[model samples]
Target chain A: MTQIYNFSAGPAVLPKEVLQQAAAEMLDWHGSGMSVMEMSHRGAEFMSILETALADLRELLAVPDNYKILFMQGGALAENAIIPMNLVGRKPQPATIDFVHTGSWTAKSINEAKKYANVRIAAAAPDGRFHAVPKRAGWNLHRDAAYLHVCTNETIDGVEYHFNPDAGDVPIVADMSSHILSRVIDVAKYGVIFAGAQKNIGPAGLTIVIVREDLLGHALPCCPSAFDWKIVAEHGSMYNTPPTYAIYIAGLVFQWLKRQGGVAAMEQRNIAKASLLYDYLDASAFYRNEIAKDSRSRMNVPFFLRDESLNEAFLVGAKAHGLLQLKGHKSVGGMRASLYNAMPIEGVQALVDYLKEFEQKYG
Target chain B: MTQIYNFSAGPAVLPKEVLQQAAAEMLDWHGSGMSVMEMSHRGAEFMSILETALADLRELLAVPDNYKILFMQGGALAENAIIPMNLVGRKPQPATIDFVHTGSWTAKSINEAKKYANVRIAAAAPDGRFHAVPKRAGWNLHRDAAYLHVCTNETIDGVEYHFNPDAGDVPIVADMSSHILSRVIDVAKYGVIFAGAQKNIGPAGLTIVIVREDLLGHALPCCPSAFDWKIVAEHGSMYNTPPTYAIYIAGLVFQWLKRQGGVAAMEQRNIAKASLLYDYLDASAFYRNEIAKDSRSRMNVPFFLRDESLNEAFLVGAKAHGLLQLKGHKSVGGMRASLYNAMPIEGVQALVDYLKEFEQKYG
Candidate 1:
């Protein structure tokens, strides 16, 4: 069988070791005679898995003690509404939320927030091309805004914010769905950091929400109890039956991350892997990543072929050569290479080699 | 090690063969060169898995051609809010939703519905100590109700509706989270049958919403697109990631169900298992199942010991004997033996044996 590299933006590749370990323990986890999926969330076995996963994730990100880690569902798309519903209640009725729209994800946050609050576009990249993250000085942030929303990494447009933008005393709410744990960040710098656990984490359906303690307990009346951040934190994300199997797999991935020397080590490798593809794309005439170099995401690299007609042939040949899911999102037609932390440099190198071979044949 | 019998209400036991298969394919599914978790939701491999799973589920339940099977997230707790958000839009402002409050789960649903619409308790078994399902003929359902809701199986209160209630022309929405797939049902009878695939299905996080085609597009303005049944059905449940790993496991479980001679065969075994445990409890002075016999849930049998003081000791001994999670919900404060389809007659026999042993020692 040909060695394959999956470049799916989300629901993307995972560490082979994690998958192997999961498979090995499917019938009986260790000698417990139960699959992790079959274990009760409140059982000692699953509780230990959940605790270790939370602890490892905290350590890997150097998260502050003041922050609470919540394992949630509905993904970042759902968090778009949940964040505003939970945060806007801290202020008066119809609270205003400041949003710096870098790309599709931030725009989604803005749209969903409109359901619960008044949303002001604090800053936006010109013309919706999502080429770069607007500078902090360019932002028109509201001084008393309930929160400042930003998509730290736009998976579709391939843009990332390298530095946390300070929006005065207003808390910064980041949609870190794509790039979470692929690199390190000061947890205290943001009021809430939420990521859908697909890329750089574990699987779809499990969402990780890290919120500062102060942000707890201010949910709008309409917010469902299961989604109320304070309630979730208090119940340890078990107010409802959480995504248990997803959590277990995430724990396994966290363990894998730790084995690879934690997030810092993974971050270094992510940087190297991403650079290999981006550098290659920059040098190739047939391919071009449109995003500004400074804002290009370390996790997702969306690029277009010089000749648009070659898209299908390019993907077809790439797939035959053991490259998979290189197709960009339908909303953004092209190619996207998502090199998350689980993606080794070798996979990226294989993709780069395939890209070159394809270009040499069809450029 | 003693063979443990897991009686968890949910996040419950799944088919052993399904777990074994899942474990075997953890690293690479059918040599597709990627874990199901690693495949893109849009990729051919995952798409094939998703399609087959959906088709098998539809066939197993005999779901009508008009009803779309939507793989969703956030569990039934979230669906309480989502249901009204989608259905209430069909009526005017403050649309009244009638609910048959049989037990804890339905009560929770009623509470959540107040946020989206005016909810009426058309029928409740509060006076019956939540031990009986309100007879269908007794329910005073609102003629103008947008939908009538019911928790067909209450995991907490050990109550199950043996018959579907007539909701007039008003759409019937059923939360069959615990006992879904344990027995076959006519899908066309209800406007929607939603179940979180944690109990008789596969895992938590994967909520299956089977909605009739006509009921798809009436989402209220406040509804999140990800939770909007219309958007979800239109997108084939790929509007969001749809909990990939959980869905894969569910597919495996659906296949396992077929191998076990489908729902009819499983239902027979379930009847035998429930009868064994219930009969033993009735005969023993030490243990008592207080739920009305007609309303007793085949899936969850919540019982109390005649001597309440022995509760702690009972649980301790049960654990020592490898009887796990027999402790009932905190609210109920006793014991619950959840015998979902995956739980064998042998497990129930073991529980009955233990009950007799305890009775011999203490009766």
Candidate 2:
């Protein structure tokens, strides 16, 4: 097989070792003569896998005792609506939810949350381009808001929050889809933290939501029981048949993360990789990354060629060089290289190498 | 490895050929050097996989040209709420959705649907036992009901609707979770037929919803955009990142089904498998199956030992004989052998042989 680097923003690249093990076990998981896909969710084999995955995730994120980790479906987009449906009932009818509109994901959360509650934009990034997160001083926090919503990392816009926004008594709900396990954080800081398990986790179907126990049990009557955090938490994420195979793969990833010395060590590698690619883009006049320096995402690095006409040629050449999925989100219309936890620094070096050579030819 | 036969109700057995091909392609799918899990849902590689799976499924079901197939998440359980959220808007406010209370799944749908609209039980099975589908003559469907809901296969109760009930102009929404591809059905008969992919399709987390084009755009305000049929159809099920790996596996299953001469041939094998097991249970005084014969599910056969105390021993002995997941649902305890499309006739024979041997020792 060719040495390939996949740069798709999401449903993105996974560890090769994980795929190898999954392939080896696909026909007969643990000599059971049944694929993990064939195991019942309530059965002993799958229960153990689910439990281990949950425990390992807890250990990796240092999730507080009060937090419940829910493995759900429908991705982050569903959760935009699901979150408000589950949380708004904590207050009286027609509650208000505060949001800091950082980029596409948060803007979406605002729109979906509107259907369930009165959505109030506490802050918005100054430019329409979403180049940075607004400073906390400028936020107009609501006194009795149901909860504050934020997208800690925007996959498409490549803006990330380096500092946790303080909401005081108002609980913060963060969408960490693009950068969940790439670095360490204080899990206790937020009331609910969710990540669609595509970019930094395992697969596209599974969404992981970590919520404080107190935050459970307030879902509105309109909330679907499957997505009601209270119901999902009570059932240990098995209110419905979960994405079992995806959970299995995520379990494999959690195991791999542990083998690589957990989140702390992985964070160091992510920093190095992100810095290498960003540094090259910074030094080169041929390409530019627009996000504010401190707000730039370490996971998804979206950039543009100084000569815009070369975009198509750049992607085609990148593919021939065994680099793939380099086209940025259509919403952004440029190039993006996602250096998820699964992406090695070697892949970064290759991307940076490609960038330099392309500049030399087309600058 | 032992020659195992898996009878898990959902997340049940899948065709061995599908698993083999999945394993073979896990690392470098079609020489792309990317596992299907790692491919973007929007990229050409995974899109092709999704398109082929949709095309194959459409062909196998002989789906009408007027219907749109949606690949979603949350299983049939979530669809209980999602279906109402999407369809109730088709009727006036405070719309009534009539349902045939057949078994556990239908009961769940009734409860979930009540959150969005008025739910009326059009008919019940006459008893709490759910032994059969109530005949159409007993149905008291609301004159202006939004839709008629039915669980075509009651997985837990082992009751199935072998005949489709006419709902007139009221669109019939069928939950075919546990028996989707195990037999052939006229797709145009139901307005929407949704199945959780774990049983006869591929893996868990992926739900297939076949809906008529006319039923596309009436989603309620609370409906998550990701779960709205119109939005999902418009985006080709990519409104959000889909369950890519499960879709790939499902695609493989569809191809395998085609190779085995499609649904008609599979249905013949299914009938043979169901008869072989049912015949033995019928002739024996030591065993009994409670579901009415005409309504008995060809997929999940729930049976009981005359000596109820021997249940544990029977399960242990069956496990020793490499027949797995024969234990019935916790709600309806005894034993159930789910012979999905993946279960070859030999596996069914093995189960019957085991049953005979166990009866000989304990009868």
Candidate 3:
């Protein structure tokens, strides 16, 4: 059987060791004589798992004591509406929300916020091509804005913010779904940080949210109690039966991350891995990556073939050669290879090698 | 291990065969060379899994063609608010939602619904002990109400509705989280039936919503697009990435159910299991189940020892006998043994045997 490297943008590749460990313990987790899925969320076994996961995540992120980490559902897409619903109420009726639209996710946040608040485009990437994050100085932030929303990493558009923007006293809310834990960032920089647990985390259903303590309890009257950050934090994410199995998988991944020397070590490897693919794309006349170098995402690298007609042949050959899901999102036609924390440098090398071989064959 | 029987009300036990199959396929799903968790939701591999799961569920329940099955997140608790938000728009401003408060879950639904629409207590279980499902003849359902809310099975109160209510021209929304697939039901009777996947299904974090076609597009402006029935059904539940891995596990459970002869067969077995324990409780002097005989839950059996002081000793002894999570919810003191579809009759007999031994020693 061919060894496969999966490049799916989300629900992407996971560390093989985590999968192996999960399989080994599927029927009985740590001699509890029950699968983690079967244990009550209130049971001692699952409670321990949740507590340890919470503590481990805090340690890994160096989260401040003033912040609350919540495990939520409905993913970041749901949070597009949930965020404004919870934040805008802190201001006044129909609060204004500032948004710096880098790409797909930011635009989604803007649209959802409009349902709950007034939305002002603080900045938008040039013309909707979304090839780069706009310069910070050009952003039109408002002092009285309820909050500023940003998609730190645009999975589809392949742009990422390397530096945090100063939002003055207003809080910065980030949708870090694609790049969260692939690299290190200051946890205190944002008022709220949410990432869907598919890429660089665990699975699809669970969502990881880190919010400052001050941001709690301001949800609009319409926000679902289960999705209210304050309610979830108060109940320790057990307000609703959490995606238990997903949280367990994420715990295993976090343990694996710790063994690999935490997020900083993973970030160094991610940097090396991203450079391997980007440097090759830069040198190759047959392939081109559109995102600016400064804004290129370490986690998701979307590239296009010089001749559009070769896209199908390129993906077909890549798949046949032990590569998978290399096709880019339909919105941005070409290819995308996501280098999450779980993706080893070898897989990136394999992708780079496949790109070169395909180029040589057609160039 | 003494052959454990897990009785957690939610995040409860699943069929051993299903867990074995999931473990076997944790790393690579049917030669896709990627774990189910690692596949893109839109990719052919994951899409096939989703489709099979959907088809299997629709077949198992004989869901009508006019209904849309949505795979959602946040469990039934989240749906408490989502349901009203999506439903109240079908009526005029300040729509009245009629609710029959049977137990804890029904009370929760009523409270959440009140946030979106006016809630009328069509009926309330006598004295709030929730010993029986209120007689339908006494329910004061308003003809002009937007919808009628009921909890077909209450996990905490251990009350189950033996029959459906007739609401003239009004849709009935049923929360069947605890007993969804434990027995056969008429899916056509309810306009919407939602269940959390922790009990009688697969795992936590996944909520199964079966909604009639006509209920699809009446969401209020505050409704999250991911939670909007119309948007979710139109996208085939991929308006947001449906819980992919949970759906896969559910698909496995559905296939296992078919091998065991579908829901009708499971219903017969469930009847035997429920009767075995209920009969013993009824005959015993030392133990008594409080719920009215007719309203006793086939899935969750909450009972009390004649002497409440023995609760801790009873739970400890049950654990020693490899019967787990026997302690009832704090709101209702005593013990609860959930006989979900995954729980076999042998587990119930063991519980009865333990009850006899304890009675002989303590009576």
In the range A189-239, model 1's lDDT, one tens digit per residue, is 899999999887888999999999999999887787889998899999998
Q: lDDT by residue for model 1 over B241-326, one digit each (tens)?
A: 87998989899988998899988888899899999998888877778888988999999999998889988888889888888889
What are the lDDT figures for the candidates, one per model?
0.88, 0.92, 0.91
Please count the clashing residue pairs in each candidate, in the order shown: 0, 0, 0
lDDT score, candidate 3: 0.91
Question: What DockQ does predicted model 2 obtain?
Answer: 0.88
Which CAPRI level is candidate 3? high
Q: Positional deviation of A108 in candidate 3, in angstroms?
A: 1.1
lDDT of 3 at B335: 93
Model 3 per-residue lDDT at B260:
95
Writing each residue's lDDT as its tens digit, candidate 3 over B197-251 gives 9888998989999999998889999998889889888898998888899999999
**DockQ for each model:** 0.74, 0.88, 0.91
Better of 1 and 2 by DockQ: 2
In model 3, the clashing pairs are: none
What are the per-residue Cα lDDT tens digits for candidate 3 across A1-363?
Answer: 898998889888999999999999999999999999999999999999999999999999999999999999999889999998889889978799999988888878788889999999999876877999999999999999999999999999899999987799999999999998878899888999999999879999999999999999999999999888999999989898999999999999999999999999999999999999999999999999989899999989999999999988998898899899888988888899998898889999998888888888899
**Candidate achieving higher DockQ, 2 or 3:** 3
The parts of candidate 1 lying over 4 Å away from their true place are B126-128
Roughly what TM-score does model 3 have, to 2 decimal places? 0.99
lDDT score, candidate 3, position B286: 88
